[model samples]
Target: MTDSQGQTPDTRRDFERFYAASVKRLVTVVYAVTGDLGEAEDAVQEAYARAWPRWEQLVAEGDPTPWVRTVALRLAVSSWRRTRNRVRAHFRHGPPPDLPGLAPDHVALVAALRHLNPEQRRAVVLHHLLDLPVEEVARQTGSTSTAVRSRLMRARRVLSAHLTDSPDTPTAGAGRPATAAQPRQEVLPHE
Candidate 1:
């Protein structure tokens, strides 16, 4: 069956083509957004699954890849937010233990990212790390373009401030318990 766009209705063949053509790129985008390879992979898979039935609608509208990517990323973000909330709840109840294999640099980066509010981090990662256009990022993030720009600016400032602080040089509260070592593991996006 085909849609009004003259394209074949979504079928196994269409799904296979979409997956083959876009999986890698989508995985990379998911990884950049979520910072967790396993989660990103799962999210992408889920997104593709969800898109399969609506393939005709998606294909008729435009590039289904972006739609799938956005869905995957939104799912990942929702998962991340839920996990973060649980962790925060746990920490509030008790002292959190140190994360294993965490290095100072990684710790610093994570800390810096954490320092920024979630919106800022999302904007920064989408715009800078993933190199997405502001409009696209806004679409993916469900924010107005102007809001995305503002978030990107704020996130950049926060990241810059955190990165600029010399690791070797002591800043106020440098040795405080709040400081944690970075994770040593190199998080590579799944191929």
Candidate 2:
């Protein structure tokens, strides 16, 4: 028997089984590469949705993992490009004058981030906030892993200096730790 979409029961079952087995791992891999969990999940979901239409062909080819992964990675990269463009446009046009005030810590963090050059900022966000490894950050940023490490080190120093110097930053006080200004280590290991 076939569904309304013309897929047979066996084909549907096979696709369902493949999705059930692969989704979690695939999302994890994509997240590691992209450094953004939301984008990773969206890309992986789109990849699986694409796979549904070609389930039989994928099965005949032996394993669909590689194909789905490639699609998801590409999608994630595309999304990143779009976001980058939007950011560029926003900078060119400038922020709206009516924007609400931010918390003091957040304001301090933004001020610190502003002190970084674009490349350093990207490296800090990807490797530190997003919790991507140096190698993966290098891959995404088109630099060597060593270069990524250097960027991270430099960024850390710069951030520390900036945060510590800012009077508005709570962490600037002698008694308080500057943890908010520091790059946090990832709790989970990358795949």
TM-scores of the models, in the order given? 0.62, 0.47
Instruction: Give the clashing residue pairs of candidate 2, or none.
Output: none
Clashes of 1: 8
Task: Residues 49-101, candidate 1: write the lDDT tens digits.
Answer: 89977777888898887788778978888888879866456434432236456
Model 1 global lDDT (CA atoms, 0 to 1): 0.70
Off by over 4 Å in 2: 85-191
Top of the candidates by lDDT: 2
| Candidate 1, superposed: residue stretches over 4 Å from native | 1-10, 85-115, 164-191
**lDDT digits (tens) for residues 1-191 of candidate 2:** 88887899989988888899989877766654444457779999999999888888888998897679768877876886789766456445533344346455554555566556656776776677557788887877779998888888887778777666446754555433365456657799789
lDDT of 1 at 81: 80
User: For each candidate, how many residue pairs have backbone atoms clashing (under 3 Å)?
Assistant: 8, 0
